[model samples]
Target: MMSETNPYMMVGERLCMDFINTVSWRESADKRREWFTSYAKWVDWCIHAEVLTGQQAKALLLEAEEKPSEAGDVLKQAIEMREVMYRIFKSISKDISPHQPDLELFNASVSHFYQTLQIIHEKDHYTLKFKQTENNLGIMLPPILQSAVDLLISNNDLERVKQCEGDPCGWLFFDTSRNRSRRWCSMSDCGNRAKARRFYQKEK
Candidate 1:
């Protein structure tokens, strides 16, 4: 059963875009920094999904000091982490038999993904220690990822996981519906866009 107050589920489809685009796109230092800044927004969305409280998210962000030079690499790692989570969520949704090899692979993947994050966090100097910033900007992943993983493990329900059906928007989301029939990432965004496009084509 889905929790009534799971913040991670409320992050919406945009979270995936933010995670993937930040790393995949090539831009100047300023643009990279701007994208990194969106991390806070991602955390905020996660908080809304009930994955983490606002206080907890804020503290997590404070744990690592942001270095301008490291922004690109950090973004890359974030995208990788998001992709791993996406795959795990999708596998859980498959409803495969318990003895299936695919299920076993999915379980192993989740474990390895978590361990890899830990190893990377340990090796990165920016993530190893907390530092005070003039503008109070810092970045960290431990608390955020931990909270999300804990929620998924506790629930153990694959039905809550969903991939958006919107065209050109292959984002992952956690469906919290009673009927479990959610399709688009957000009705106001992707859903509306799709509807509008269809209408335009019909008019033509």
Candidate 2:
């Protein structure tokens, strides 16, 4: 069963956007909630994010059972990387330059994960892949980082990255609309709340 604490909202169209949005009600210190409380929860999120398959998750869980400390370390690393990504993208959405320290940290991770880069030969052609080590439970993180890196360098597409207009929502998304007018993360959730608030103000 999925955890009730996290609704697993996939409102962010891009994988990196969705990964950065794991937290709920981000700006309200009283209501803010973190989704990846433990290694298992992190793995579950990766599964829903399609960053890991069932078989891969199963193996990682088994390994985590044996190396709890290592698993915890991975969780910490994942959250840290996610926060760095959030800050970088949040600045982009607001038309400001991301902090230099954040960019350096992001590049550090990119350099670290790039070590696992390998070329695999397929029937028709070759493909680049991140090799998974049997003992590394954080294997699912590389692709997520790669997604952010791709977007950061996407030039014109970076303009489509936006934060929800909903107050304190703190959710980021990629606007794929032809006219790039998307504001809320989801029309059914934050969007409806905004509409209701506007209506109430009009009546009052």
Candidate 3:
């Protein structure tokens, strides 16, 4: 059920999966639309994806204005990381190993971001947190990366990761169906179109 007005279609049950699905028509060269056109757009998606609060997004946007070039560089880095993640996860969904270079790139990001990891005691309970500054424009990326890492190491859960069978739609989602019969990115969109196509061909 995708809304016409809303650009955010979060069928991916996992945060990292949704992040990997930021592009529309990913496998279609002509129709593909990149959601993260700028740092501000990335921040906007981060807010929609619940990776950032309104206040944090505002702070980051302000900082980005103050350092436009740095912001652009961070955006480029984020997109590159996203492509690497997409390839790795897509490979996993196909029951294949990710390319060695892609895995190395992913490990590099994991190593870099996890350095900000720290333990915090709140209300007599200990929890791990990324303790980077509030205005860190790339702060939203670490959590998404952690989500991917968690899924990758979950072993059994890796079986649940699937790419939509909707041709060039190319969205990935965590298949939560009990029988694992799910296929398209959405029953209302890709699924319906596929169904109609079958009917049309039969009639023809």
lDDT per residue as tens, model 2, 24-128 = 888778889999999999999888888988898998999999999999999999999999999999999999999999999999999999888999999999999
How far off is residue 40 in model 3, in Å?
0.8
lDDT by residue for model 1 over 117-199, one digit each (tens)? 43224554535222323323223344445544554665655566665666555555666677888887678766899899999
lDDT ranking, high to low: 2, 3, 1
Stronger candidate by TM-score (1 vs 3): 3
All predictions: root-mean-square deviation over Cα?
10.6, 2.5, 1.7
Model 1 TM-score on a 0 to 1 scale: 0.48
| lDDT per residue as tens, model 3, 58-143 | 99999999999989988998999999999999998999999999999999999999988999999989999998865387898899
Ten residues in sequence with the least summed lDDT for candidate 3: 1-10
Model 1: residue 131 alpha-carbon error in angstroms? 16
In model 3, the number of clashes is: 0
The C-alpha TM-scores of every prediction are 0.48, 0.95, 0.95
The ten-residue window of minimal lDDT in model 2 covers 1-10
Give residue 158's lDDT in candidate 2 (0 to 100): 96
Error in Å for residue 194 of model 3: 0.8
The list of candidate 2 runs beyond 4 A from truth reads 1-7
Clashes of each: 9, 0, 0
